[model samples]
Target: MRHTDVVIIGGGPAGLAAAVKLWEQGIRDILILEREHHLGGILRQCIHDGFGLTRFGETLSGPEYAQRFIDQVEKYKIPYITDVTVIGLDKEKKVTAAHKEGILEIQAKAVVLAMGCRERTRGAISIPGERPAGVYTAGVAQAYMNLQNIMVGKEVIILGSGDIGMIMARRMTLEGAHVKGVFEVQPYASGLPRNVEQCLNDYGIPLKLSHTVTDIKGRDRLESVVISQVDEKMQPVPGTEKEYPCDTLILSVGLIPENELSLMAGVKLDERTKGPEVNEKHETTVPGIFAAGNVLQVHDLVDFVSMEAEELADSVAEYIKKDEKAEAEHTQGEEAEEYMADVVTDGNVSHTVPQKISGKKDIRLCMRVRRPMKNCAIQLIQGGKVIQEKKMKKAIPAEMIQIPVKAGILKEKENLEVKVIW
Candidate 1:
């Protein structure tokens, strides 16, 4: 068995950032295990130039952004195990992993989970079709086209208007494919506003909202798709059915956090985010086991992922230097609280992160709305008293909204409420 002060699973941006931060904090005994042969994770396949505007203050391709972090890891001489997959974790933060070399075990004082997320496939959506050859997830299609220089098809109809789907629509168009349109089940687009404008609108690509691809028809290759509009109940309207003939179909329904190791380690998960339940510090229910990046919540940008990783690394350093007994006592005290705030969704609200709060510290509430509204007001109320309010000229579901609460606000409140009023 090997021992280390810190063990980070997955060597993507999150893991690399955590390692760098830990190194700055004077923690040297760290190990990063990556399943792939190299680092960067999904960013390696993305060759577009829109990344790193907020983080680096410059437009960079995905690989370029990853290269910046890779340089840090190399400069610090961080030890890493590539092509090693973590299979499980125990209560004591023991990590079990396997690679070509065979099974390896590591007893780590603290573990950071940055395994990232996976794309939703056709099976998850259950689109009716002949298990055809032309269907691909947006990410897979991106890898095939951008990295492998393989053309997926000449005609495409993308299902879902998420960022990946929107981006791929433009990519296919640039590659000389005829993009029929993009269909979204939700009433509003799930992608960022700039993506929708630059990727879809600028190219005259159609976006069908409140509509879904009800059926896919093909024999060997994708031939066509039948789309229909849906009502508030999400049931298809019988008369609104329309068919579009296309050679390929791309689905970007959603992303699910890779949490098998988290489950094995007995970490509590949030039902809404479909990720691990984490506090402000990004620590899970199991002490010394932390999670960040897309594993905690699906961030819209890589900049937010880096920010989360930096904060998580600080927490790990504190855990390593502090007394174990005192840490356990503090954790137990926080868990002993009975009353907690449930941030619910109303008419226009979509979902809120950090689903449960203990009212013990200052917190930032991040959320998205269900639709676009003009001249809207966001109100934070507790026990019929307004604690915070903000006005916006326009608010859309595509962008995430963040509101920070001071510790003083929680001192007098038993219940916290968030609402959108237009």
Candidate 2:
């Protein structure tokens, strides 16, 4: 079959960034396979301005932000095939894909998993309701409105105050639709503070926390929804149902990392993040197979996704530079276990990226807290001693917390622990 030094799946932001970085490192034999007909991934549908602030120090729309990378790929003449959906991946780095022509196979020296993520739907959360036509995920609604020039509904009820949901609430309002309200099951808003303020407060859209839609009304099309307050356990409170009439119900519950191909390649998954477990180098348990972007962990920002992909690209370059036989032998049996350190977290931590570290160099640990807390400190512990600690004014589940640790303190440590205390 065809052979390449690197084969990246999904020509999204992550794959684009990784491919560019690999090319910059003098890796010429590279190919990118994208399932969609075009590049840019989710950013193509996201038309709002406010992206690229951290990455480019400027406010840009989603398409504009993605275009910068797309331009770079063109300048470098990086090869990418669109409308090609990868159907299978093996441990030996062979990729099977299907396109308009027929089945395609590639023998890759290294594979980067950049498949990104998918929006959680009504059925995923098990929202009790009759199947209605007006219900849509926030992303789907965005694509319909921005790409297809179709309005989802006149009156909208958004469930889950996710960043996308909040943004859609503002979009619907601007489009002359009356947004009933945004209901969240969590005690606190799931979206960023800026989103809640700019999207909801500025538009006068009420965000009802500790509340959820218990029942959905209407038969063929959405007519109304029953909202109810939730207790500490997030269970719906009795006799607290409030009916709000609306033509559409938009769900922004959550995002799940796309990993069906990764699983086929036998990558170990982290239950906490619902993504593949990776080391500091972003390499999965299956050697030469690496994952980045949302496929590794759900990132709060697209900038971070690109940054992580670049870092993983560096590791992939190093892998290609080494002897394949020696690298494989070194990562087997007891040597592999000794080469990596296990990372453990306290109950306060929701999850972490790079579940293991080499302890050979400094690393930036990324994680999120379980809930919001004021006056908290995140401690990096080794052998029951706090090696490093960072105090924060506040910690929230909506934001990711990154801490940089020194290698000197972690060198001899077999296990490292992370604790969030308030």
Candidate 3:
């Protein structure tokens, strides 16, 4: 058995970022486990140039962005074990992993789960289709084209207007394939607005909203797919079917966090995000075990993943150095006196983050309205008193709304309430 101060599972952007931060904080006894032969996770196959704008202040391809982090890890001499799969974890931070040589166990003071997410496939969507060779998830198609040097097909119909599907639509077009169109069940496209504009609209790709593939037809490979418009409930509308003859079909419906390890460890999960339920420190229900990146919540950009990882590292450092009993006492005292906040959603409000408030500290409340609104007023109320309010030119569910609370406000309030009106 081996022991480490910090054990980071998964060597993607999140794990690597966490390791780098740990090194900066003078924590040398850290280990990173990667199942793949190399690092970078899904970014290796993401060869597009839209990444790194937020982190590096320049547009870079996925490989380029990954290389930057890989270089940093090497520079810091962060130890990593590749081609090793972590099979089990316990609440005590004991990790059981395996490699070709043999199995190994580690007793870690802190463990960070950054295993990322998996793409939703045809089976997940239950699309009535033949088990044909041409059907592939958008990520699989990307790997084939970008890594294996294999063009998936000459013609394609993409299901799901997510970012991956939109990017692949442009990629297939550039690679001399005719992308028939993209079909999305929801009325609004689920991808980032910039991707929709730059990847699809700039390339003349048609986006079919409130639409889905009802059936697929083919023999050994895909021949065609039958699509139709969907009603408000997403049921297929009769008499609105159309057939598109294509050799390939790519499904990018959604992503599920790879949480088998978390489940095995008895960590609580959030139903809405389908990830672990974490506090402000990114620590799961089990103390000393943390999660970040896509494994916590599927983020739209790599920069966000990096930010989450850095935050987790900071938390881990503090957790390892602080006295457990003292910290628990402090936390209990803080929770006892902390004011609570209720974020009430009105028209077009979906959900809010920082679900609970730790009244001891000033909080930044973030939320999203359900629909787009013009000339909207966002109000922060406390016990029927208008505490803080702001007017905005526009509010959209796609963007996040943030409100900061100062210590002065908490001193005067017992509870926080947020609402939006137009």
What ranking emerges by lDDT with the best candidate at the front?
A: 2, 1, 3
List model 1 lDDT by residue over 1-422, tens digit each. Answer: 99998999989889988998999998999999999989998889878888889888999998999899989999999999999989989989999999898999999989999999999988897877577789999999999998889999998999899899999999999999999899899888889889889999999999989999888888888788899999988889999999999889999899899988999999988876778887656778788899988888888888778877998898788878773555766753123433455555566777776665667767777777778899999888777878889898988876778788786776332656779999
Top candidate when judged by TM-score against the true structure = 2
Q: How many clashes in each structure?
A: 0, 0, 3
Ranking of all predicted structures according to TM-score, beginning with the best and ending with the worst: 2, 1, 3
lDDT (Cα, tens digit) per residue for candidate 2, span 1-422 = 89998999988889999999999988888999998889999999999998888889999998998899999999999999999989999999999999899999999989999999999999898989778789999999999999999999999999999999999999999999999899999999999999999999999999999999989989889889999999999999999999999999999999999989989999999999989999888999999899999988988789889888999999999888664545677853223453788899999999888899878877889999999999999999888899999999999999989888888888565788999889
**Candidate 1 ranges beyond 4 A from true positions:** 324-348, 356-361, 382-384, 412-415
RMSD of 3: 3.4
Q: What is the lDDT of candidate 2?
A: 0.91
How well does candidate 3 score on lDDT at residue 36? 95
- Stretches off by above 4 angstroms in model 3 are 323-349, 362-374, 377-418
Tens-place lDDT digits, model 3, residues 1-422: 99898999999989988999988987888999999999998889899897888888999998898888899899988999999999999988999999998998999989999999999989888999677789999999999999999999998999998889999999999999999899999888877788889988999999999999999999999999999999999999999999999999999898889999999888988765687876556778788899988888777788878877887898898877663445766753122322444345454555544454545665555566766679999887767787789899987654556677675665333556678878
Q: Rate the local accuracy (lDDT) of all candidates.
A: 0.86, 0.91, 0.84
Q: Report the candidate with higher TM-score, 2 versus 3.
A: 2
Where's the lowest-lDDT run of ten residues in candidate 2?
Answer: 329-338
In candidate 1, the residue pairs with backbone N, CA or C atoms under 3 Å apart (3 or more residues apart, or in different chains) clash, namely none
